[model samples]
Target: MKFLFPIFALCALLSSCQALAGSQAGTEAKFAPETITAFAKNVEKYAAAQGAGAFIIGRIGRPQQELPKGIRFTHTAIAVYSAITLKDGSTVNGYAIHNLYQETGKPDVSALVVDYPVDFFWGVHELSAGIIIPTPELQQRIIAAISSGKNKAVHNPAYSVIASPYNNELQNCTEHTLNIINASIYQTTDMRQLKANARAHFKGQRVRSSRFKLMLGSLFMDDVTTRDHDGKVVTTTFSTIGRYLQQNGLVKHMAVFNRDGSSGELL
Candidate 1:
């Protein structure tokens, strides 16, 4: 009976191990294109309900105003009338704006660049609500690009339509909305603490951090800067400091400046 008991215990242990392994394997296999598609569709429906479309356009260094006219939507554009039905018996009307470099003359082989969120309107509020439906085909293309590990440079000019009066808020409000959306998309961390730390470290000191890097990360560090309260120039080292901030998710859209005495001001 003792020997039988020991054998039973061994069987139970093996069964438990097998069950755990199976659970892990199931989890590993749970990546589904349908799931991604469903999420994209839901976002689309929400954006439509908000009286906006999905699709956004902006360059890293350029002013949002400079976005091209062709990319902007007009009331007459075909995309506005197109509707996508959602699982909840609602429909979203919009089109997907892909980031592709517009070829000057040749039209066949436009390369893919960094994919950004496409919003229906010029304002961040409208853009934030825009739904980008990543169809299974789109997902497959993105996966292929990821597997290649290549940086696709998009040369197409960004397109946009005129801003509606309904979305034209104070410039600061627009800036704030832009920052929030960008941070959310990029998975940036809360900068309340990091900004405080940076201000404490760089105030009244000739430090090397670019205004752009201080805000958006190394990706756009080369294009941003600011003068310290004491009139000293601060530059960010794109290779080192910029990368460091980016990896830590401390990069934000707000400017970090030396406040009165030793405090950091996030503007």
Candidate 2:
């Protein structure tokens, strides 16, 4: 049984990392092509306005089978922006995006890698996105955590589309991101202790799914264990994390652009 579980876990990771293509049919985009294009072009501008520090951002990417509810964005990534000076005495702005990338058809916990927003939004299905600029204190903590490899340490590599929001044992992209945020705040890489603290600090959203969807998830995905959807209904997502930060006063500023091309403050 133990060996079998690992095999199943591996299968799930492979399916998640490689086939990032949206599982849900591309729904009608909320913004017209021009609007989404312009938004992508100005991503750096918006990110820069958050200050040259470590922050987090999310985008409405490939539609997954688990249709989101009351959430504006589905995928999340950490953005660390800084300035670079070239030998020619010119300064340029650049960003290193810290995110979890699932490899193609691999059954292991995805690793935390630095990806640019251009690459990050390659397959985005919507024009909407959200950015969370952490407080100065929180920003330093996040940067420290990443430098100390806490982000890599907390990742489970096993991808679960319907991973329990509370559990850190099996993680998806958002859960992995959450673990990193929690670990950074606590200043520890100890997974058990972080999970314990998260129980109190993190409150996930209650999401409901149909039996058909649950069955499909269970049959194909190894990480979506029976415990995922049986009892607790809450799941961690981009919006939930933003709400948590905003409610806790850890965020300095938050901005969200809806599918309608309208922009507003999240906090």
Worst 10 residues of 2 by lDDT: 17-26
| Superposed model 2: Cα runs more than 4 Å off | 1-38, 62-66, 83-92, 107-109, 228-230, 258-262
In candidate 1, how many Å is residue 201 off?
28
Over the stretch 174-193, how does candidate 2's per-residue lDDT look in tens digits? 77778878887877878778
Tens digit of lDDT per residue, candidate 1, span 1-267?
A: 778985675554333222111100001212244443443344444434434332222211112243222211111100122455658999864544333332333222233333212321222211112122222332333333333432121111221111111111111111222222223333343444323443443221133333333333212222111321233432211112223333445443211111111212221
Which stretches of candidate 1 lie above 4 Å from their native place?
A: 1-30, 54-93, 100-267
Model 2: residue 28 alpha-carbon error in angstroms: 16
Q: Give model 2's TM-score versus the native structure.
A: 0.76
Per-model lDDT: 0.27, 0.66
